[model samples]
Target: MATALPAPAALLLWECAARAFGLLYFPPPTSIAARAYHLWFSGPPAHLFLTAEAVEDLLPSLTRLVVGWTLAAALGLATGLALGRLPILAALADPLLHIGRAIPPPALLPLFLATLPIGTPTQLATILAGVIWPILINTADGVRHVHHAYLDTASVFQLGRARRLLYVIVPAAAPKILAGLRLSVSLALIMMVVSELTASTDGLGYRLQNAAGSVDVPAMWAVIVLLGIAGIAANGVFLFVQRRLLRSGQAARPRGHVLAWQQ
Candidate 1:
């Protein structure tokens, strides 16, 4: 949806021009597009065919992403909540978080390679570990940022813990929590491909690395472009959801003129 404009065409023109100068490194636009088309519309890609059909590929990568990212999200939310609500826990773990996030996920491949068995499982773990931090930190910060006034209001109303959670704390903190997940959604995908780059026999990342390895310019270019599109689409979806949720939140706020209530 984001690319449904004349601007993409302009990019295609530039891509074509870039290729003209360096054919070896930069394949033509039509060639890359054709290769991308082949990935989706061709035949069974799991095994060799007369030609390529990559349309089915999104499912495998997405399945891994769903599993890994969901796990990360669950952990992130739980950890964020605990840390955000408890200063002591936050103090204990925040430093580790700051340190861990500084290291890139790819740099850890050698460690994973040596420690974990080589296969799909390792890839899943890589994506999960890489993506979890955003969720954890964001949720904690969101939870921390929950207004004291809200808590006080809940107390005055004699609201039960469940009611307080449902009506006050969650609403106040949800935007930031979602913000973290939004970030992880993209981070998870990048790591998903990165995992495949080193570990997988299949998937888009594998296709990209293999293409570069064998000099299949078309296929390499194809997967790279598709990956770019996928990343962009994921982010766009997150932003759209965030805006919608924020709008709903605004509408749900208590609406009344201030009649000058004094404590």
Candidate 2:
């Protein structure tokens, strides 16, 4: 209850300021909210109240965001684990990894556009390029820094390589990996919007660009607000899942090896 006050309070303040100043560019929140509802949520109940515009734009954007993020997460985790487990490989790849991550993702949009198809492929590539670094870097760092005691314990238990990784390395590194994932979620959302801003037919970003091009301030604000809501919702869901996973992992710990996990 306390935490929710800030947003509503800010919106109320914004509403008063916009109304008082009669700002053409910054319309009141009421108008923006109305525009958003009519634009996206004015459909019939059978269609889940999604307007055609929403169906055409919102769904595609969500699909791309999910698919791109999933692919990046999978690749990042796998490569990070391999590199973390192999010091020589990590050493060999460190320079290249740094260079790759250093380049801004948006800067590569042109290259992606030239090389890939202009629609979903380009968007996915952009998202993957942008969001993979955090996950990879954090996962590697977490896995590499996992206390040697954990490894020793695994070895003493005669655990197989896969078992050791599943039970020890991954569980130990879960927190850092989850942190990376959380960070990447925001990056993925940003990239999703950015990737749609050009060379695409439909998406929230495309709609935003269209609205901006038409000088539709209310529509633009609506898109911006929707994006903010999406970001907040995504973060909330990620945090909930993270907590649940951590709790389950802790609960699943073997009694005999509890001290090792605690350490």
Candidate 3:
């Protein structure tokens, strides 16, 4: 309760300032909230109070974000695991990985646009290009640093390769992989908006662009607020899943094994 006061207090101050100054561009919070609700949330009860614009624009952006992020996460985890397990492969790919990560995803958007269709495919590629590096690097680092004792235990049990990877290696490295995933969520959202900002007909970014062009400051603020809410919601969901997975992983391990791994 105490921690939550600051945000509302700050918003109240902002509202007072905007109203006092009669700022056209920076509208009060109340007005912005009203605009946002009308634009995206006001609708028939059958559609869960989602306006047609929200259904058309917001849902597609969210779909792209989820699909693109999932693809990046899968690809990153697989490649990272292989690299972590094989020093030779890691060595060979090290320079390439460094170079690839250094290049910004948006810089390659032109190439993607030229090659792929100006829709989901190109958007996904942009997201994958940007979001994969952190997950890959973090997973590889985590796996590499896993306690050798764990591996020795698996070997003593004569665990097959698949079983060893699934049971021992993945759980051990999950913390790092999850950290990478957390970072990638934000990157995925940014890429989603950027991918839709140009050569696109629909999505939140397109709506934002149109609002700005038309000088609809309140609408722009509404979109910005919606994006903020989306980000917070995404992070909240990830944290919930992270906690559940970590707890389950700990439960599955032998007593004191997690402490030993931490040490």
Candidate 4:
């Protein structure tokens, strides 16, 4: 609800609200700002840009996020395509996939930590395992929803494997892929932080936990705000990409003529 405000009004409202009551639970916004500022500026390393305290904290999280999500995307898309296009595979795997996807990923943290490598590698592997299911499941769903007419047209043309996949399958399945990507992106960030909070020595999540333990509530709150801001910014970016992919996919088609339509 607060997001609907015009920028000026939002700032004003935020200031007023914080001044009125925020100190009861959190430091007012200014206290959070002071903590954020001191973290980034009150240091000699500022010239190196790692002076930002959370640089040390945030980098590991970002690293795990990027690596894990990329792996998930690659594997998920491949698996999803097979599930969507192959009847026997879909029949065999769909039920299990549904059940697996429904299970919360963090519940497996104990199992993962027991078997996976330690430190950064373990964090990344944990994030990947946790976040991958949404991408895989959504991509499969999207592939299944591909327009039937498109498949029939490809059949009529007797398209070769390369041509069929390049022209028909990928294009037809793109909107769904983009949707799945959005879900996976959010999942990736969540898992990245959760992994850190659970075990990693460094990360925004770790710092937040550390600050809380030290009773540095203002710093903890600042980190939480940053996480919220990061989530918003990431979704904005995903939406921008989604618009481009959707538009480009549409533009690639001969919308001017309908008979040759193939997804």
Candidate 5:
């Protein structure tokens, strides 16, 4: 209750300020919510509550965000695991990875645009580039920090490389990996908006930019609020899943350790 009040309280203050000042630039939260409803949710239930504009703009943004983030997660996990486990590989790749991580994803947008056409691929590439680093680095760090006792137990049991990684290292490192994923998700959302703003006719970012340019303050505020809602919703879903998975992993861990130690 305490946590929830601040947001609503701030919004109420904003409403009062906007109304009292008759501010044309900063529409109140109520106006923004109404604009959002009119733009995206003023539809019959049969249509799944999304206006045509939502189908045209918001859906594409979400699709790109999911696709790009998924690809990054898969590749980052694989690369991170390999690098984490193999000292030789890590040594060879460390410098290159550092260099890559130092450059911002948006900085490479021009190269993406020049190489790929100005479309989904380019945008996905840009987002994937930005979001992959945290997952990769964090996963690698987590795996490296896995208890040596676990590895010794795996060796004593004569567990194959694949089995050891899947059963021991992954489960132990999952908490940190998931933490990285949360960061990656947020970065993915930001990159999605930025990529659209840079080169797209539609999506929330482009609409926000267009609204601002056209002096549609209410519409601009509506887009910003929608972005915030989307971010909070995505994070909520991820954290819920992370909690369940981690709990299940923890439950199974003692059995795994006992079996490994006995062998």
Candidate 6:
């Protein structure tokens, strides 16, 4: 509640200022709220509180966002683990990885469009390229720093490679991995909007661009507000998962401590 208080206060301030200034371009917060309700939720609550426009516009963007981010996360984790486990391989790829990271993710959109058929594939590629780096880097670094004592224990216990990775390495590196994931989630949202704005017939970004082009300021602002809400929801959910995972990891640590002590 303390964290959430500022948002309402900020909105109240915005509403007051916009109303007082009577700016033609800046729709008062109240007007934006009403517009949002009409555009997305004026329909009967029986329809899961979604309107036609939202079904057409919002859902597709969300689907693309989820798919792209999931793919990036998986790829990043796999690649990071590989690199972290094999220092030689990481050294071999370091230059190439750095070069790729240097290039801005959105700048590759045209290349992706040329290579892949338009629509979802292109958008996914763009978002993945944009957001994968943080997770990849963080995971690699975290896993690389895993205490050598842990690896020695795994070896002494004759643990299989899979068990070492899943039961030992991943949990040890989870905090840093989650930090990277949080960053990538924000990047994914930003890239999603950018990809839509650059090329797409529909989605929140397209709608935002369309509103701006048509001088529909209130509608534009409403879309921005909706995007903010979506981002907040995503981050909140992910943070909850991160906390649960961390707690589980903590619970498992004592067993490892006992084993090490016995060894």
Task: Give me the candidate number with maximum lDDT.
Answer: 2
lDDT tens digits, residue span 1-263, model 6? 79999989988888888899988888788899898888778876434767778887888899989999999999999999999999999999899899988999988999998999888888999999999999999999999988777888789999999999998888878899999999899899999998998778889999999988999888999999889998999899999999998888777787766465346
Backbone collision tally, model 6: 0
Q: Against the correct fold, how does model 1 do in TM-score?
A: 0.85
- Candidate 4, backbone clash total: 0
Per-prediction TM-score? 0.85, 0.94, 0.95, 0.87, 0.92, 0.91
lDDT of each: 0.80, 0.92, 0.91, 0.79, 0.89, 0.89
All candidates: CA RMSD (Å): 4.2, 1.7, 1.5, 3.0, 2.9, 2.8
Give me the displacement of residue 52 in model 6, in angstroms: 1.3
For residues 121-239, could you state the per-residue lDDT of candidate 4 as single tens digits? 66777777777786777777777776767778778999987787778877877777888889888888888888888778888988988987899987888888888888888889999
Candidate 2 residues lying further than 4 Å off, grouped into runs, are: 1-3, 254-263
Scored by TM-score, the top model is 3
Which is better, 3 or 6, measured by TM-score?
3
lDDT tens per residue, model 2, 58-140 = 88999999999999999999999999899999999999998999999999999999999888889999999999999999999
Instruction: Please identify which of the two predictions, 2 or 5, would achieve the higher lDDT against the true structure.
Output: 2
Ranking, TM-score, top scorer first: 3, 2, 5, 6, 4, 1
Q: Between candidates 1 and 3, name the one with more favorable TM-score.
A: 3
Q: How many pairs of residues collide in each model? A: 4, 0, 0, 0, 0, 0
Kindly indicate the candidate among 4 and 6 with the higher lDDT.
6
Tell me the tens digit of each residue's lDDT in model 1 across 1-263.
Answer: 76687788877876878767776777777777787676675665554442344534566687888898998999888888889878998899878989888888788877888889986778878997899988988888888877677777779999997798778877778888888999999999989998988898777777788888999988887887877888899899889999999789767755431111111
Q: Give lDDT tens digits, candidate 3, residues 1-263.
A: 99999999999999999999999999999999898887777875435667788887788898999999999999999999999999999999999998999998999999999999988888889989999999999999988888987898899999999999998998999999999999999999999989988756889989999999999899999998889899999999999999999999889999777768878
Q: Give one digit per residue, the lDDT tens place, for model 5 in 151-263.
A: 88889999998999998899878998999999999999999998998777878878988888999899988888789989999999999999999898877778766465346
